[model samples]
Target chain A: MQGLFVVFRKELCDHFSSYRFVILFGLIAMVSFITSYMAGVHMKENLEALSKTRFSFLMLFSTPGALFSMVQFVSFFGPLIGLVLGFDSINRERAQGTLIKLVSQPIYRDAVINGKFLAGVATISILLVSIVLVISGFGLALVGVVPGIEEIWRLFIYLIISIFYISLWLGVSILFSILFKSIATSSLASVALWIFLSFFVTLGAEVAANAIAPMDRKKETKPEILIKNTRIKERVSLSSPMVLYSKATEIIINPMRKTTGSIVMMMPMEQILSSRFQNPLPLGQSVIIVFPHMTALIAITLICFAISYLVFIKQEIRT
Target chain B: MDADTIIQTVNLTKRYGKQVAVDDLNLSVKEGEIFGFLGPNGAGKTTTLLMLLGLSQPSEGSASLYGLDPLRKATEVKRLVGYLPENVGFYEDLDAIQSLEYVANLNGINKEEALGKIDKLLELVGLKNDARKKINAFSRGMRQRLGIAEVIIKDPKILFLDEPTLGLDPEGAIWFMDFIASLNRDRKITVLLSSHNLSQVQKISHRVGIMINGKMVADGSMESLAREKFGVGDKEYSLEEIYMEYFQEV
Candidate 1:
């Protein structure tokens, strides 16, 4: 535990002092604050249409009409902050010839990996929380609104889950760092995985579902095949951290969003959801709706961290 | 059971697939002795040093540091061993003091105690003035000097220096050797110096072990190896002449 803290403190300093951290901090802050400004500007246009929720302060971050809401921007690009911060964590040290000397110290190998991981997660959490508070402040200044206590509580949960999402990506990049000896190779692998998971996965899933179970309105398609196709596509999309993050954050930030998947399948026929915009679910129930997505993100993060730890301990530094 | 023997290896062999890196070897260094580990490029000096440090596992046999097996009790072994790898580096952004403080902290030394020791070490290594300078601005010789201070940070009983003088200029090399000799003489720190440079090893080492083709071809005092290779005559031979005497073939 002592060694872990020592490593963690040193690594935290490295992250903050690095240009990578500065660039990531600037990029996220700029995008998030800009999205909040845009969302606040557009919220006035659809004030009456939004319905019932007088305290829709969350909408300042989740604007429906904008090309990109702040929340959406975060859900999309936030993982890159993690990827960039951690892509070269191990390999860069190996390349610079510091790992050998580091491991030679009277410290266990596990502490090295654990300390780096904890430090990365902590840095990301701090950055995200500050950005969240900044966006909230923008909403109040631009749109003449302050979030209710309940909205603030929900936003806090949103921040926690987003950190989890980013941690998973951080774990992945660190694992790549351990697997590849060269910093360039590890970074390339991390970026390639990021692009595939964040953007192309959704497109690829849809194409794959179409091939597996074609959907044609012109010819009457079987209901089972259509359901199968949708299920396969959903399964593929769920593998991506972006999809998981987007799903969980959507419900957390927007109270009116009831279910993550099809509302028809989840609700029975007798308990009919009204055709009108339904009353928003309570904060607790909203969290219940996204609990599975949160669990999946955390699970993947732990699994990746564990694999990196084991591989690191087994690897020969001299080679 | 000899208390004077600080490092002992019995039939230590490291093989990678069909190629062997270090063949079965039996070697030992007495406490406070400077043992020069001389070998050609592929003779596995680095590999042997790594196994002794518990950084690599041997394919056969075993090694012990002060009677503790490195592979079995690495933390205990590491606590008493300080290693200076070839071309060592520090965090480029950190100054010499910060880097040394980090190393001290890693070895569980408190800052209060480490501060005084770090100062003394920097002065000894001729890096006291550059203690505030970042490692990025340091020349290769300076990093090597810093590397020495880092190696002795914990006051370890044994020192494993692999190619310690590889990049230093002649004057810098002499300075480094003098420092090592002082540490060995005053502090009784056992030194295992591995290098392909035979002359540098000849200058500081109390004994020499020559490795060729993954096996020890010669192991004894310089006089014994010289007398054996150059034939029993009252003659002084440089390490290069003795080296050619054995490796004159392929």
Candidate 2:
């Protein structure tokens, strides 16, 4: 425990002293402020142009909607922060020739990796949470209403989900740090992986599904294409956690809004409950679906951490 | 197996792919002795040091420090050992005092104790006046001195220094030699230092182990090895010449 604390303190202090924390927080703050301002402008325009109806206090419930969009934006940039913070966690020590000095101290190699992960996570968490609070405060003030218990609950869930998503990226960064020996290589590898997951993975999954289960040529004139497309869409949807979370949130937030439109325009749980059936899946079932995504996020994070630990332990550190 | 033996490596070997860095070597360093590990570049001095310090594992045999296996009981061994690598660097933005404090914290020293000792260590290493200056502003010699201060913070029973005086000026080199001598003589610290500077090693180390082509070619007291292995003659054989002679035979 003491050894772990030592590594944690060293990493944390280094983060602050090296301008890592400053740069990360500055970027997150700038991005969040911009996103909030944009959301505010859109909301103001809708109110002025559409009707004289006061901006609904219920729009504050849309904090999750804003948060969801921002979370996606944050994810795109989060990995860069993770890569920068973690890419040199070990390699720089080896390059600077401090690995021997550090390992020679009374500490386990696992402790070093754990401490680094902790520091990186802590730094990101603090910056992101601060942004969330700032956006939430400004949003509440703009909407001009006190959020109800249910709305607050949804926002809390959104915050927790975002944290898990960030953790997933952090884990990938640490894994890259362990696999590559130079800071440049590690950073590049992490960014590449981030790009693959954030963009290419979704596109690739779609292309793959289409290729494997192509539209039936014989039934091109039939309505089966629609049904096949729906199935393919659902399968492709599973490839993206962001999509799943958004779907689940929409379902729980406003089940009353329903659509017989394509599955793509399907309403969230709240709309489904109010429209399709007198009673939707009990609150518990709705939570169950949303719950697995959080679990998946956590599980992936742990797996990344486990892989990093193995690589670090087995690493020669000669570089 | 004696309690006095600070380090014992039995057939310890490290291989990078097909090339053996430290091939099947046995070595022992007793407590309170300045044991110099001498070799040319690529002769596996750093590899051997890393294995002994538990930073890298050996492919074949085993190593123990103070009766504990470095592989299995690494944390325990590390607690009692301080290592200075060939190129020592600190967080460039941190001043001397802050760097030392960071190291002290890693070594589990209490904050109050670490602060007090940081002052004393900075004074000891002649960096007290420049403690507030960032490490990037420090000269190579100053960095080396600070490195030494970091390693010795816990006053470990054993010290592993790899090329401690490699880039130092003559005066700085001499100061480092004196510091090592004092640690061994006055404080009874066991030192296992690897160096390519043969003459400096001879001056400070009681016994020197000469490695060639990943093998220990000679191991004995400085005088005995010099006289017996190199031969006593009117024309003196430098340590480099002796090293070449041994490798030539292989």
TM-score per model over all chains = 0.95, 0.88
Candidate 2 overall lDDT versus native: 0.74
Per residue, candidate 2 scores C-alpha lDDT tens digits across A205-308 of 66765675576667553345545666676566555654554554544444332321344334467456555564324434555656765676667778888888
- Per-residue lDDT of model 1, residues A1-319, tens digit only: 8889999999999999889899889987987777777777788666667756655798887884347887788888887888988999998889889999888888887889999999999999999999988877777877777778989888889888888888988999999999998888998999899899889999999999999999997998887787788888888999888999999999998888888875423435423663354677889999998999998888988998999989999999973
Q: How many residue-pair clashes does candidate 2 contain? A: 13
- Which lDDT tens digits does candidate 1 get at residues B17-95? 9999999988899998999988778789889998998989899999998889998888888899999998897889899
lDDT of 1 at B7: 92
Error of 2 at A12 (Å): 3.3
Docking class of 1: medium
Query: In model 2, what is the error at residue B105, expressed in angstroms?
Result: 0.8
